[model samples]
Target chain A: AQSVTQLDSHVSVSEGTPVLLRCNYSSSYSPSLFWYVQHPNKGLQLLLKYTSAATLVKGINGFEAEFKKSETSFHLTKPSAHMSDAAEYFCVVIHTGTTSKLTFGTGTRLQVTL
Target chain B: GAGVSQSPSNKVTEKGKDVELRCDPISGHTALYWYRQSLGQGLEFLIYFQGNSAPDKSGLPSDRFSAERTGGSVSTLTIQRTQQEDSAVYLCASSVRTSRDNEQFFGPGTRLTVL
Candidate 1:
């Protein structure tokens, strides 16, 4: 079975500073990785995804993630943290073959402060 | 075009009651999924339905939880004898279910509260 692990349960960063949220995965077959953000009372929005074509993936809201196969990691990063970035982030993974199920991480609550 | 939509955005029911949550997937989408999000559990896969194929319900927590999708367009998730632990957000998503990729369009989700 495939699974995802979010190393941090919560992360706090000052406005204008860089932000990072770590994610790792374990899948029996090749996997599709994704980052989704959820704001209060809002539906989950896909930030980015890695389908093995590119190691570095750029997402919406100026967020990005790099897929490191050697380390089994897909850590999300941003050059600058904005207050609007405060929300819950989830790391998701799908099995290699098509028509697969998705496995979500525990979730990381991001808090951006001034 | 309208995105995925769910009914009863907010539901409040007493314990031991049964509740039905509805989802209307995007037009022409062949794949649909149901997931539950709790306070700490993030998102838990509940079921998957594609076309007229049998749904994959391996993620269902218990027999009390069941779901059905008709005409490959709409779905309803039913919870019998709801409990406090059943209080959470139910999310529905639709996709093309292609063999090469699956990009799901998600709904706002139905927030259920069992008091």
Candidate 2:
């Protein structure tokens, strides 16, 4: 079985400050990891993904994540926070098995302040 | 290109009633998926369909939940004897065929509330 754990349920960052959202995953086989952002009353949008091709993955809106196999973690980061970045973020994992269903984490609500 | 489409953006029904949620995938995408999102449960996978292959229902919570995809395009998820706990946002997504790296495009969800 595969599962994703988000370290924070909520994070507040002032505009122009750095943003960080932590996540850890567990999977029996090789896994594909992803970060998705959801604005209020909107559908989820993929930020980035890591499928073992690269350790560092860059995404839209100046966001990125690093996959660390040894630590079993994939944490999202941003150099400068923006008001538009306030939203809900989910950490997801898909096992290498044939079924190929995505398992989502509890999600972290980011609050960007001025 | 049009994103995934889901009908009846909101629904409210009484317990014991049956409800059906609809989904129309992207023009050429062959894979569709259904999920439930609630305040308590977050997001839970409900079903998946790839082309004409049989769907994966491993995530359906119980016997009262069922779904079907026809002609490899449109899909519907039906809930029988709806319970209050069934209240949640139902989400649908579609991808370009079956690829490990394929990203899914989601539809604005249907928020269902069972009284």
Candidate 3:
């Protein structure tokens, strides 16, 4: 049983301020992590994925996340927020062995203000 | 290229009725998946099909839920005797199974409402 917990249900930031959406994971083994964004009435788009590669992963739309093994965290960060960045973000985990099913977090709703 | 697509963007049905939802995967994707999104459950995997392998029904919530993929491209999920708790947005996704990246492209979900 692998899962992710999004620390915040909602996060607000100014247009030019840095944004942070926290996520923590619970897994018995090393698990692949991912971040996805869903705009209003739109399908989810992958932001970034962390396999066994780099600890610091960069994603589209100026977003990045650091995978901290000891802390069991994969927090999404952005240097600056834009109005277009307002969306629902989900943190997902997959243990890719016998099954490829993903376990998703409750999601964090981002709100960017001018 | 067109991404994964789902039909009947919105559906409203009465309880105890049956409903079907369809999904069309990317042209060359070998793996397809079904997921449900709801306020109560967040997001949950419902089923999975990969190439010619037997479909995975481990994620399905109950016996009333079933799915099938035809010719490895299109899939349909049928829920019999739907309940109000079954009302949720059903999402479809496809991916190239051979690729280690394992990124899945999603379709605009079909929102199902049971009254």
Candidate 4:
């Protein structure tokens, strides 16, 4: 079985400040992790993905995440948050069973305040 | 090039009515998937299709939910005698192939409201 957990349901960061969204996963096999962002009424957009290639992965919009195997965590970080960064972010895991499927976390709603 | 697209962006139907949601995936994409997202909830996997055949229908919530893909390009999800619990945003995604590394492109989704 494969599952993901978003440690924070909501995260507040000031514009120009750092941002962090925490996620963890449980998978019987080596997992492929991803972070996706969704704006209101918009489809999900992939921010970054970790496929065991590198511990730190960089994504679009200046977002990046570090995959920590010992801790079983993949946390998203941005050096500076912009107003446009306010959106719901989901942590996803690809389950490699009979048919590959994605398992999503509840999501973290990021609020960028001035 | 066009991304995935879904029809009937919003549908409000009475309980017990049957509804069909359509999805047109990216051109040449061989793998398609259906998911349901309830209010404030995470996505629930419904089904997966590779070409015209579905090998994994285990994610379907109930027998009333059925899906079919034709010509390996378009898909339709049919809900028979829908209930209030069936109200949610139906999302469709497609990828070049079914691999852990292949990224899935998503559609705008179809919002269904059961009254």
Candidate 5:
């Protein structure tokens, strides 16, 4: 079975400060991972994905994540947080098995303050 | 090109009533998925359809839930004898194909409230 764990349920940062959201995973085979953001009452928008090509992946809105095989972690980071970045974020994993089913983490809510 | 679209952005039904949620994937996309998001919970996979192949319905919670993709395009999720605990946001997503790299595009989602 494959699953993801979001280390924090909520994160708060002041505008222009660095942001970090941690995630860990457990998968039997090679795994595909992703980060998605959702605004209030909106559908989820893809932020980035790591498909084994590179350990570091950049995403929209200046967000990025690094896949660490040793730690079983894929942590999202941003140089500076913006007010518009306040939202809910999810970390997902797709097992490399035939089904490739997507498993999602509970989620981390980001709150950016001015 | 249009993205995935779902109908009845919001629906409210009495307990024991049946409801159907619709989804239209991007043109030419061969994979459609259904998920449920409860308050403070992660998105739970409900079903998946790939082309004309038999759907993977292993994620469905109970017999009260079922889905069908018609003619390989539009899809509908039906919930029979709904209960209050069944209320949640039903989300639909589609991908170009079923693969590890294929990104799934999501729709606005339907908020279901069972009274």
Candidate 6:
């Protein structure tokens, strides 16, 4: 069984400050991890994914995440947060042989303020 | 290229009424999935369909929920005797099975409210 936990339910940051959203996972096998962002009333948009390639993965909108195997964590980070970055983010995990079904975390709501 | 699309963006129904939600997958995609998002439950997988193979329905909450993909293109999710707990946003996604990346494009979703 594979599952994900988003450590923060809400994270508030000032515009132009750094942003961090923590996530941890438990998977019996090698897992594929993903970070998705959802704007208010909008469909989810894939921010990034880690498939055991590079430890550091870069995504759109200046967002990136590092997959730490030892820590069992994939934390999303952005050097500078913009007002547009305010949204709800989800951490998802999927293992092989599960028909590609995703197990998602509760989610982290990011708030960017001026 | 058009992404996944869902119909009846919002529906309000009385308890015990049956409701149907539709999804149109991306062209040439062979894999489709249904998920539900509610206040209590963040996101829950409901079902999956790939090509002509049998759909995986292990994630369905109850027997009242049923789904079908017609001609490997469009799909419909039917809920019978809906209850207040069935109110949530229904999400649909589709991906190309030929690729190992497993990136599923999502639809805007249909919001269902049971009164």
Q: Write the per-residue lDDT of candidate 5 for residues B43-69, one digit (tens) a residue.
A: 899999999899999999999999999
Model 6, C-alpha of A60: deviation from truth (Å): 0.4
**lDDT: worst 10-residue window of model 3 chain A:** A94-103
lDDT by candidate, in order shown: 0.90, 0.92, 0.94, 0.93, 0.94, 0.93
lDDT of 5 by residue, A1-114 (tens): 899999999999999999999999998877899999999999999999999998999999999999999999999999999999999999999857555668899999999998
- TM-score of every prediction relative to native: 0.95, 0.98, 0.97, 0.98, 0.98, 0.98
lDDT of 3 by residue, B1-115 (tens): 9999999999999999999999999998998999999999999999999989998899899999999999989999999999999999999999988343699899999999999
- lDDT by residue for model 4 (B1-115), tens: 8999999999999999999999999999999999999975669898999875645898899999999998888999999999999999999999999999999999999999999
For candidate 1, give the docking quality class from DockQ: medium
Residue A66 local lDDT, model 1: 97
Better of 1 and 4 by DockQ: 4
Q: Which residue segments of model 3 deviate by more than 4 Å? A: B98-100
Stretches of candidate 1 exceeding 4 Å from the true structure? A97-99, B98-100
Residue pairs clashing, model 6: none
Q: Arrange candidates, best DockQ first.
A: 4, 5, 2, 3, 6, 1
Question: Which stretches in model 6 have alpha-carbon errors above 4 Å?
Answer: B98-100
Candidate 1, residues A1-114, lDDT tens digits: the string is 789999999999999999999999997767789999999899988899898788999999899999998899999999999999999999999755445667889999999999
Going through the candidates in order, their DockQ values are 0.57, 0.70, 0.65, 0.83, 0.75, 0.62
Error of 6 at A6 (Å): 0.4
**Per-residue C-alpha lDDT of model 6 across residues A1-114, encoded as one tens digit per residue:** 889999999999999999999999998877899999999999999999999899999999999999998999999999999999999999998647647887789999999999
- Best-matching candidate per DockQ: 4
The CAPRI classification for model 5 reads as medium
A26-102: candidate 2 lDDT, tens digit per residue:
98776899999999999999999998798999999999999998999999999999999999999999756555678
